[model samples]
Target: MSDPSEMSNVRILGDFRGDPSPSTLRLALAQVLPSDAESRPSAPDQSTAGKEDDSDGAELAMQKLRLYAQTAASQGADVICFPEYFLTGAMHSSWKAVRERQEPVAAHPNPEEDESHWLAQVAAIARESDIDIVAGTVVELGAHHIPHRKDAQHKTGGPGSASKESSDSAVASKTGLRLRTKDSSDLLFNTAYYITRKGEIAAKYTKRNLWHPERSVLSPGHPSSHPSPRLFNIETRRGLRLKASMLICWDLAMPEAFRELLQPSDSRDGPLDGPDVVFVPTCWYATDAGVKGLRWNRAGEAAVLDSLSMARALETESIIAMCNIAGPNWPNGGDAHSFQINDNTKDEDLPIVGVGHSSVHAPFLGCVGKVEDGNEALLLAEIDTKLLADARDTYRVRYDLADAV
Candidate 1:
C-alpha cells in the first residue's frame, strides 16, 4: 500500500489561468511542432512531401520539444503539459497510417512496434527531467493480430477485425481474449493519456465526445455511470488519487459533456475525491495562434471559446488548463497551409476570420494563453485548486445541480 501523504501537494502547471501567480508554480509553455510544417515553403510542392522526409520533420519537432521540455524543467515545473500531438500531428490519420494500416473498424496498426518505442522515448524524457507529462493524445497500437485490439491487457486501444489467420493462431495459442470497444489488429484509440511520475500511463481517457470528422476516426467514450462532477482520478504511487481528467477540444462546445466528467472516481467521501483540475487538449483549426487576429473560422469567435470554458468553470469549479497548437496546423493532415502572427506578424495584421488559435481559460478570468504560431505551444500556469468552492455559491449553479441530482 502507498503512503497517504505522497499526492497531497500537486504543483499544477499548464496554460489556463491568466496572470497566474508568476512565482508560485513556475509554468513553462511547450512551443513544439504541430505537424510537418514548413515556416517558408520553397514554393509549391517543391518541398519534401513523402513519408521519409516527414521522419526528418518528426525529428526536428522532437528536438524542439526536448529543448522546450528541458527549458520547463529548468524553470522548476514539477509537471509539464504540451498541446495535442507535441511529437506527431493532432489528426489521428497519420498515426493510423504510419503506425498501422486499417480500413474503418478493422484496420491493423501496420507499424505496430513503433508506438511503444515512441512512448518509451517520451517517458524517458519525462523521467530524466524529473517532470510529470500530460502527453497529448497519442495513438496506442493494439497487440491482437486481428483487425482490432481489445481486452484487459490492452484497454483503450482494442481489436478491430479478427483475421482468419490471427483467429486461428488465437485458437491454437489458447489466449482467451474477448473484444469490447476495440479488437486485436492494433486498434487505434484517440486518448489524452496522462503519465505519472513513475512513467506509466496513470489514466487513459478516450475522448468522451467526438467532433466532426473525428467521429469517423475515433470512438466516443461511453459516459461513466457516476453522476458527479469528477470524471477520472489517478492515484499516485503514494496513494494520492489526484483528480485528473481530460476533455478534448471540440467537446468543449457541449456544456452537457462536463456533467459526465464532473462525477468523482474516488470511493472516498472527502473533497479530495473531487477533481481539483481539468485539462482541455485542443488542435485549434479556427485561428492561427502565431498570427494573432486571424482565424480559419471567424464564426468560432472568442465568444464561443469564452462561453464554452466559462460555463464549465463556473458550474464545475474546477481549474481548467487548455493547450493548443499555435502554428500552421495545415490540412486536416497539413496538406494545406496557413500562417500565424508569431511567424513575423502582429495580431492586428490579419483578419479575425478563419484564423482561430488555441487558448487557456481559467475560472476567474479567461484567455490565459493564446498561441499565434503554426506549431505546438504550452500555456502553463498554476490554478487555485480551491476555486471549486465558489461554484456552490452560485445560486443558479447550486439549484441546477441539485435539481439535476
Candidate 2:
C-alpha cells in the first residue's frame, strides 16, 4: 500500500520507523470493532462487583489498543488514530451512571503512575509503539473548564453551523442532561486525548458539537471560552511536521467546526493559518441519518458520511482523516431490523452496527484511501504535504478568504 513516489524518498535505513520521509506522513486509521463485552451494558451489579467488572473491561480494552498500536507501528505508520469513544465504548449511559462507572478526569492525580487509568495506559502504548496516537475518546467526569456566560450567544458560526438551535435549553432538556448553568463542578464529557511518541499528553480536545443522542450524557465544549485554537503540532518519524486538531462525531456535520480550525488566528501559535490535518474520531451509526419518516432509506446515512467528509476536504483545502467504529453486519447488507439500536430509543444500547467508512481525504484528491465496508481494518495512506500545497495554489481558497476570516 506504499505510494511508490512517496516511498522513493525513504532512506531505507532499516525498519519502518527508521526510513523517514521528510514530506510524507504515513497515516494509519485503525477501524476497530470494540469488544462487545465492554461496549454492552452489564446487568446491575453490587458496588464491589461492578468495580471489578469495570476494571476488567478497561484492561481488556487496553489490550486491544496496545495490540493495534503495535500492529500499526510495524506497518510503518508514523501516526495511528482510533475511532471516537473507542476506549470506553459507546455506553450511552446516563450522566449519573457514567459518573459512577468512570473516573473523573480530575481524580487522576498521576496518569503516569496510574496504569488503571485509560489515558495513562494509552500513553504507555504510544511510547511502546513509538508512534503518535489520536486515542479516540473516553467518557469521563470533569469540572467545567469554562465558566457560564449568559451572553455567550449559545451559537457557533461557520458554513456548517447547526441553525436549529442545537444548544437551546429546550432542545437539551429533551435529554435531561442540560445544566442550569454552563459551569458545574461535576459533569460528564466525551474527551479525546492526543499522545506523542514519547507519551506526553500533547493536547486534549473536548468535543464541541454533541450528537443529539450524546446530549443526554455529555456536555459540549464551550464555543468561545478559550481564545486560542484547540490545536497541536507533531514532527513525524520522517521529520514531516504537521499541525493538527481533533473533533468527535457529529461535529463533522457542522462546517463551522472546520472553519474554526482552518481559519487563521493571530492569537494562535501553530504552523500555517491553521491545522494541516484534522482527525475525527467517531461512533456514528448507519441508523443515525435523519428523523423517523425523514430519511430516504435505511442506507441513506452512508451517503451522508461520504458526502460530508468530501465536502469538508474540498472546502477546507486540507487533509481530513476520519476513523469510525466497526461493527457486525448492515453495511454488508445485514438486515437493519435484525440489528439493535435506533436514534429515538431510550434504552441507550451500544450500536450493533456502524457505518465504518474510515478514510483519508486530500483537498483536490477527494478520498485518497478508504475502507469501503463496516469491518475492522487498518487504513494506511501516504499523506504528502505537496498535494496540500498544490491544492491551495490551484484553488486560491486561502487567498480569497484571507481578509474574510
Candidate 3:
C-alpha cells in the first residue's frame, strides 16, 4: 500500500470562496488505443476459452494500465485518467452483442466478489504506480449484472457456468474472496472507480446516462438506488485539494446533469457545493447516423463534443477533462484516408472510429490541452484554482442563480 500521508496534510486551495494563491493540479489524460487482442474486428469467445486464455485478456489490460499510469506519474501528473469501457475494448461490436444475448440476470454467481476481484487489481495498479487513478468504466456483474467480456466465463454453456453455485463457492473458499453486496439479480452497469495512490477506493460513479447503444446492454445508474451526490476530492502533489466528479461518454450531451452538480449544497464550504473539476471518461465515436436536413448531424459528431465540453466548463465554472478512446490505428501511423469524409457514402460504410480529441477545458481558457485528432496521445494540463475563482467572479452565474431562487 502507498502512504496515505502522501495525499494528506496538503494545502487546501480555496475555490469560489476566494483564498486562491495560484494552486495548480497536474492532470493527465490517457487517450489510449485498445489492446490488439480486444481491438480486433472480431471478439474473443471467453465462453470457450480456458482459464489461462481468460486471464490473458485481463492481464493484458492491466499491463497497459500500468504502463500508462507509470508514464503519467513520470510526467509529473497528479492524477491519470483512462477512457470509458477501456478495460473491455468497448468499440468492438462483439462485446455488446454477446452481452445483449443473455436475458437480464446475475452474470456472476457471486457478483460482489467478482466485481471486487477486478477492482482490487485496478487498485493494486494505482498503489504500485503511486498515482491517483480514475480507472475507466468497466462492466460490473451484480444484481442487475449484464454479462459482457469477463462475464462470458459464466456463460450458460461454459464449463464454469455449470453448477455455478457450487463451483463459485469452492473458488471463493480457495481464493478467500469476501462478499460485499447482497443483491444478486441481473443488470449490467457501466461503473467508474476512483482509487487513491494508497489503493483506497475513494469513490465509485456509475454512468447515469446511457448512450443509445448502451441502453440495450447496460442499465442507467439511479441515485435513488445507489449513492447520492457523486463527487469526491483529489489531493494533488502541489498541495492543492480539488473537488472533482466523474461522468461517462454520452452524459456529456446532457447539460441538465452538469447544471445539477453546480447547484449549491447545504454544506458550509462553498467550494464543496460544486465541483472544481469534472473528469469525463469516454469512448465516443466519430461517426453517427445522420438525420436528413440536419447539417450539423451530417457533418460529424466532433463539433458537438467540442461545443458541449467548452460550454460545460464555462457554464459550471469548472474545468472539464475528457479522456476519450483513440482511433482504430493509433500510436502507430494509419492512412489519412481513414479520416476522410465521403458525403455520398452510406451510413453502414462509415467506420466506427473514436473521435479522439481527448481534452482538458477550463473556463475562458477553452481547451488547455487536447489530443487534436483520432490518434493515441497523452494530454496533460495544469488546472489552476485561480481560473475557477476568476470565472466565478467574472460570471457570477452561481450567485445570480442563488439569488433568483
Against the true structure, whose lDDT is highest?
2
lDDT by residue (56-163, candidate 2, tens digit) is 665676776777677677778888888986767565542345667665667776675687766777888888889999998877777745534542345456788666
Model 2 stretches with alpha carbons more than 4 Å out: 1-20, 35-52, 94-96, 101-103, 145-171, 174-177, 180-183, 223-228, 265-272, 290-295, 331-351
Q: Sorted by TM-score, highest first, which candidate order results?
A: 2, 3, 1
Q: Quick one: RMSD of model 1?
A: 11.9
Q: What is the per-residue lDDT of model 1 for residues 1-405, given as tens digits with 9 covering 90 to 100? A: 112232122222343334334223333445444654543231222223333435666667665555566555655554566666555554344555545433332232322224545556666666666666677665444332232333233222237856655554453333232233244344445556566555665555655555554444443444331112335554422233346567777778777766655543243432222345567766554433324334344334445655676677666666566566555334444322343335665543442122234554555655555544444444455544444455544434534554455
- The 0-to-1 C-alpha lDDT of every candidate, in the order given, reads 0.49, 0.69, 0.65
Which 10 successive residues of model 1 have the least lDDT summed? 1-10
**Per-candidate TM-score against the hidden true structure:** 0.61, 0.78, 0.72
The alpha-carbon deviation from the true structure for residue 195 of candidate 3, after best TM-score superposition, in angstroms, is 0.7
Indicate the TM-score of model 2: 0.78
Instruction: Tell me how candidate 2 scores on lDDT.
Output: 0.69
lDDT (Cα, 0-100) at 54 in candidate 3: 34
Collision pairs in model 2: 160-255
lDDT of 2 at 103: 59
State in Å the error of residue 305, model 1: 2.8
Model 2, position 360: C-alpha lDDT score: 85
| Candidate 1 vs 3: which has more TM-score | 3
Query: What are the per-model C-alpha RMSD values against the true structure?
Result: 11.9, 8.2, 11.6
Clashes of 3: 8
